[model samples]
Target: MTEPTRLGGFLRKSGAFLVVGGAAFVVDAVAFNLLAFGIDGHGPLYDMPLVAKVIAIVVATVVTYVGNRYWTFGTRALQRKFSRYVIFVALNIAAIGIQLGCLAFSRYVLGFEGILADNIAGTFIGQALATAFRFVTYDRWVFPDDHESSARTAIESA
Candidate 1:
């Protein structure tokens, strides 16, 4: 592929990641809301929003992994990619910690105890920063489309 074509492909992949991430975010947010505030009354995790967030993240991450592997990164080598997937999950957990930290700080330390503050600290600002970090790290480390590796594989088989 030409350089411009390669760039275009990368941009398209990035856009797809953003779309998938948005969907996953919705999943995370909905699950959190439901867990923290049940339909009829307060849920089991009502007082423990951080724990609820963890559960929500795990659910959303399963959705995200499938979307990223099949749609965004387009890796068909499932067996080989499994290790990378594990690493990605680990990194994602760390990213979730960032959001949790922000919420904890705002809610506990700063004494900004409100749903609006929680959303602002954990969902909006934290997610934005974590997304930026994830995009770059995922492209480079988690799911690199390594031309060198492909070339080497072909050479070895030949």
Candidate 2:
């Protein structure tokens, strides 16, 4: 029956974020693999891994948006639906860039063209970086706390 400390709240929120992100990651990975490297090592978009990644990210973005909106940051003040979705998509585009950069570096720069390498570079490393970016940006901008929400409201009304 005690108030949760700030750190405790953050930890709980982070846990929920991780769960949502994990589900999104699974969707992204499965889609990317299926499109880029099928069961027989030749997927539909096998020749174009970047395109495959973009498509996968798009699908996973939908999952993340829904999960984060209703589960991860459910208690946060709601913003205008259109505006929130636009901002969410913009931030996701940036995160996709992070993922793409890692994948591109592994595929083009490092001359890595294997499933394992792609997963390590794009799925693991890139996701880690992008997840950190998303957590901060989502908390601060996409789903602001009460104070920030009020300030945003003032700015919108001005």
Candidate 3:
């Protein structure tokens, strides 16, 4: 591809990624709010914040993984890749820890009104770092190796 064409392709792919990422963020936020606070039909899981958060994060991660694999990276579903995805998610858990830890520290230690602000702040930071890690791993390791220009090429070689 020409320089301009390659740049355009990159930008097009990037736009799709932004859309998928935005949707994933919405999924995470909505799930967290509903599950942790018991908003929207869920019961007030006030005492079980940890459990609620875990569940919510898992749900959000599923959506993100599916979107990224299918749409962003244009990869088909593969069982082996799912195993790699698990490890990817394990790393994401660290980011989740950072997010909730920030929320707890800011709300309890710093005595903020609510951690919504700090939680959002922390999550933003964590997501950026974690997503970069995810992208690198997904590209270099998770998805199948494609020595050829097309997946068909790799498949035929295999």
Give the Å error, residue 123, model 2: 1.0
Q: State TM-scores per candidate.
A: 0.83, 0.88, 0.67
Name the TM-score of candidate 3: 0.67
Off by over 4 Å in 2: 1-4, 151-158
Write down the worst ten-residue block by lDDT for model 3: 113-122
Candidate 3 residue pairs that clash = none
- TM-score-wise, the better of 1 and 3 is 1
- Native-to-model Cα distance after best TM-score fit, residue 6 in candidate 1, in Å: 2.7
Q: What is the Å distance of residue 148 in model 3 from its true position?
A: 4.9
lDDT of 2 at 63: 87
Give per-residue CA lDDT, model 1, range 6-71, as digits (tens): 899889888988988898888887887788767754767878978987888788878777888789
Quote the positional error of residue 106 for candidate 2 in Å. Answer: 0.7
Q: Order the candidates by TM-score, highest first.
A: 2, 1, 3
Candidate number with the higher lDDT (1 or 2): 2
Number of clashing residue pairs, candidate 2: 0
Backbone collisions counted per model = 0, 0, 0
Record all residue pairs in model 1 with backbone atoms less than 3 Å apart, i.e. clashing: none
